[model samples]
Target: MSQSPPARKPIIEFRGVSKSFGTQRILDGLDLKVHYGEALVIVGPSGTGKSTILRLMCGLLEPDSGEVLLGGLPLQAEQLQRKPIQVGMVFQQAALFDSLTVEENVGFLLYEHSKLPRTKIGELVREKLEMVGLDPVLARQMPAELSGGQRKRVSFARAIMEDPTVPDDETQLLLYDEPTAGLDPIASTVIENLIRSLKQRGSCDSYVVITHQETTIRSTADRILLIYQGKVRWEGQAPEIDACQDPYVRQFFDGKIDGPIQ
Candidate 1:
């Protein structure tokens, strides 16, 4: 008899989750799973709760109903600030502090919370910057001194930095919100390649990316999920995306103007 392969394990699970802001429901009775060693890219029209999904997973937001779980344990929103789960986030706008230098920004958590010496923190900062394909010299510069792409890269560097409080194995989930948005083709390609390279390097065991860019969707996703009207409209492997016949999936893949999306 042939043995079956082991089941894939999810680092995080959204079980019957629902979220609403006043009367506007964002996610409704959603069930989603983010597994280990995979890239799951989420795509949808504006305000379809793409970013909200990221927030829920990273514990920035709590669902009005159901639970977000880590290793089958429910995650509380307050746990995020304690760095207990070791999640890294690349925000939509990069979210750099204008007052801090690149080095300071990348090393902010370590500088504030870790007892590591300043010289050592600076070295780690340089290493992360270089890993992101940025010059270490940029570390001395401010956010305003960099281009949009550079800022995004710096944000990535910051996300990958180790939090001393969290165990090394705990830092396996990476969440990106609109990582490639508002960039030129070359810049977008850079972000795409970076995502692939990070996967290749095993920088994180799993990544969840929220993006609207087609190139990003094609390049970064091992699997794809389409959210529409507070639900998962479709989901499949990246290559299967084009052949999916669901009307919403078809409309999104073809960039159609007249569809249920609107």
Candidate 2:
């Protein structure tokens, strides 16, 4: 019998990757892969380089050694800026400018990158803001005038402003950094619901959400990778997490620092 051809390659691949700042190693010969249309959540104790993963993918930083592959090919700054394969990011602080209105912030990237008319950009902004469940009126308000939740929503809208369209059947990869941080329970719920909706309604092939909120993880992740001391030490599905026998995994999940990490 003939074996089927090897499966399609991963969308993003990190092989024997080691990253460092001088002598401080942030990623230790790490090997991880993210496939098309799979949402992967990475959680770990503080200082484990979860954010570094996003930066590497976005070309914000270069690894000290090893390779980072995008679409089964090696990556570099020049290629990332070109088009199509572009990714979206929601930073930890929601990083919105207090001086700009929601509309302007969302339209910022579109205006800079595209020759679309001013009128067309406005329409895109309104449409995306609506998709995130924000009032068009809110779009006209300055960032400072909105609640923390509203600002986060605005940031999400802005991330998608240039992201590949969220389709009904395909998965768009969104790398979110601490999306629910500093929000109240209600706001957190809204954010979680939005995450779930993205999985259900959009063509989001995958997402990597970095957060310490257990509830947020419970609601959004398909699988969890545990990073400690700047490397991934454990990984498992959400349900399997409760039964994880790895002491480090248990310690992090149970909030104990006196174990392997100590």
TM-scores for every predicted model: 0.93, 0.91
Which regions of candidate 2 fall more than 4 Å away from where they truly are?
1-6, 77-83, 163-171
**Tens digits of lDDT, candidate 2, 1-262:** 9999988777788998889887888899888888876778889877889999889977788888899887667778437544235567889888997788888899998777777787888988998888888988887899989889988888888877652332333325688999999999999999988877765666255778888899888888887888877677988888887888899878888998589976
For model 2, what is the C-alpha lDDT against the true structure?
A: 0.81
Name every residue pair that clashes in candidate 1.
Answer: none
* Tens digit per residue, CA lDDT, model 1, 79-148: 6444345678999999999999999999999999898999999999999999999999999999999999
- Looking at model 2, residue 4 earns an lDDT score of 93
lDDT of each: 0.88, 0.81
Query: Judged by lDDT, which candidate is best?
Result: 1
Which pairs of residues collide in model 2?
37-205, 38-205, 170-203, 171-203, 171-204, 171-205, 172-203, 172-204, 172-205
